[model samples]
Target chain A: DVKVTQSSRYLVKRTGEKVFLECVQDMDHENMFWYRQDPGLGLRLIYFSYDVKMKEKGDIPEGYSVSREKKERFSLILESASTNQTSMYLCASTVAGQGAWTPLHFGNGTRLTVT
Target chain B: DQQVKQNSPSLSVQEGRISILNCDYTNSMFDYFLWYKKYPAEGPTFLISISSIKDKNEDGRFTVFLNKSAKHLSLHIVPSQPGDSAVYFCAARGLNAGNMLTFGGGTRLMVKP
Candidate 1:
């Protein structure tokens, strides 16, 4: 089974504070993604990395940024955390692109509460 | 504009009954569709998928049907179980979308015993 691990399960941060959410995948999948889930909005992609040091912006990527310095680890950075940025953050990994019929394997998720 | 949409916000069904979840999309570029199930405090997990070429796919008690012309899809779960109660999200991906998937708002399904 593929395992995706997130460093934090629940985090509380003050406004303007810097927050870092870390994720690591045991399988050497070529793709990693970060997404945020709200009550009715479902899961929206924040950022994804196809390779180390390579990142692409997803639909909602304004307040968030990501890093992939190593193949197995991907980090999501909030330069200045805000109230609206508080949401359940999820990390996922796949062996290849969706076109290749690979479903994303996801972590338990980190619930961020920015106050 | 929302590319994918799930009209129903919630659905309730009794055990041994059938649960049907619907999804619609506006983008013609999408060539693939998927359904994911998510529980509270947990990330969404892939459920079932159907390619544009095929209209229907079945696995156990779960079956997914697609109507390409209508740009719609539906998931049918027969003899619903309480464990199946969760949020169901419908997702789509196109050839031009690369590795990303666009998801609908999702519908919460409750299966009662």
Candidate 2:
């Protein structure tokens, strides 16, 4: 089985604070993604990394950025957190290509509260 | 524009009944569709998927039906159990989208015992 681990389950930060959410996948998948879940909005992609040191913006990536310094680890960074950024963040990884034929293994998720 | 849509925000069904969740997409380029189940605090987990080549795919109590012309798909869960209560998200993948998946707003399904 593939395992994806997020560093934090819950976090609270004041406005304008820098926040970092970490994720690690044991499967060594080449693709990693960051998504935020909000009621009535479902899950929206923040950023995705296809390889180490390569990143692409998703539908909503204005306030967030990502890092993929290593194959197993992907980090989501909020350069300056805002209340609007408070939401459940999810990290997922999958093998390259194959699309829906390949399932994305996800972490439990990190609930960030920006106050 | 919202490419994928789950218009129904919630659904309730009694145990042993069939629960149906619907999803629609506007992008005709999408050839693959998937359903994911998520609990309150957990991330969405892959449920079932159907390719455009097939109209229906079944696994156990879960079956997915796709209509290419309508650009719609439905997931049916028979003998619904309480454990099946969760938010169900519909996702679609276009050939050009690579690993990126377009997700719908999601529908919350509650099963009562």
Candidate 3:
């Protein structure tokens, strides 16, 4: 079975503090994604990496950034955490050419709360 | 603008009954649609999917029906069970959208005995 591991299951950070959320996938999928899930707004993509060292901003990328220096690891960075940034973060990965047809494998998710 | 929408926030059904979750999209360019099921503390898992070219797809107890003209889709679960209680999200992708998917707000389903 494919497993996507998140570094933290729950995290609390003070306002204006820098925060990092880490994810690693054992499936060796070429596509990795970071999304924030919120009530009534659903899961909004923050950033995604098609390959190592390459990243693209998604719809809600204003408050977040991401890094994918290694193929299996993708990291989401919050330069200055704020109260509004509190939400459940999810990490997902899928194969390359078949991304459209392939279902994404996701981690258990990290719940971040910024005070 | 919200491209995908799941109007109902919650639904309740009895075990052995049918549960239907609806989803709608405004983007005419979206050709691929998928449904994902999520439980508390876990990530969303793929449930079923139907392409614009096809109207319906079924897997086990789950079935997805798509209506391209109306930009509407629905997920149907037959003989719903207690374990089927979860949040269901509807996602859509355009032809060139790659792996990026636009998701709906989600519908929470509770199956009671």
Candidate 4:
């Protein structure tokens, strides 16, 4: 089974602090994504990387940046954590062209709280 | 603007009964639709999906129905069990959307025995 792992299951950060969320996939999938699940808002994409060193912004990417220097790893960075930034973060991976038809394999998710 | 929407915030059903969850989308660009189930503290998992070309797809007790003209879809679970209790999210993607799937607000389904 494809496994997408997130570095943290729970995290607490202070406002204005820099935060990094890490994700790693073992299936060697070419597409990786970061999304935040908020109440009433659903899962909104933050960023996605289709290849090493390549990144693209999604629906909600204002307070976030991502890095994919390594194919198996994708990192989401919060420039400065804010109270509103606290949310459940999910990482997912899928084979490139099969995205539209195939379902994404997702990690357990990281719950972050900013105070 | 929310492209995909699940108007029901929650639904309750009894075990062995039919549980129907609904979803609607405003964008005609959406060509494929999917249902995802999520438990607390866990990421959502793909439940069932239906392509625009077809109106229905079934897998075991789960079935998905899509109406292209109305831009609406529904998931049906027959013989619903307590294990089926979770938040059901409606998601969609355009043909060329890549790996991005737009998700709805989600409907929490509780199956009581």
Docking quality tier of model 1: medium
lDDT of 2 by residue, A79-107 (tens): 99999999999999999885456887889
Expressed as tens digits, the lDDT of each residue in B13-62 for candidate 4 is: 99999999999999998878999999998889999888888999999999
Which pairs of residues collide in model 3? none
TM-scores, one per candidate: 0.97, 0.97, 0.98, 0.98
TM-score of chain A of each: 0.97, 0.97, 0.96, 0.96
Ranking by DockQ: 4, 2, 3, 1
Candidate 1 per-residue lDDT, tens place, A5-85, comes to 999999999999999999999999889999998878888999999999999998899988899999999999999999999
Which residue runs does candidate 1 get wrong by more than 4 Å?
none
Calculate DockQ per candidate and list them. Answer: 0.66, 0.68, 0.67, 0.70
Q: Tens-digit lDDT track for model 3 on B1-113?
A: 89999999999999999999999999998878999999999999988888889999999999999998898999999989999999999999877778778999999999999
Candidate whose DockQ is highest: 4
Clash tally for model 1:
0
RMSD of 2: 1.1
Candidate 2 accuracy as lDDT: 0.93
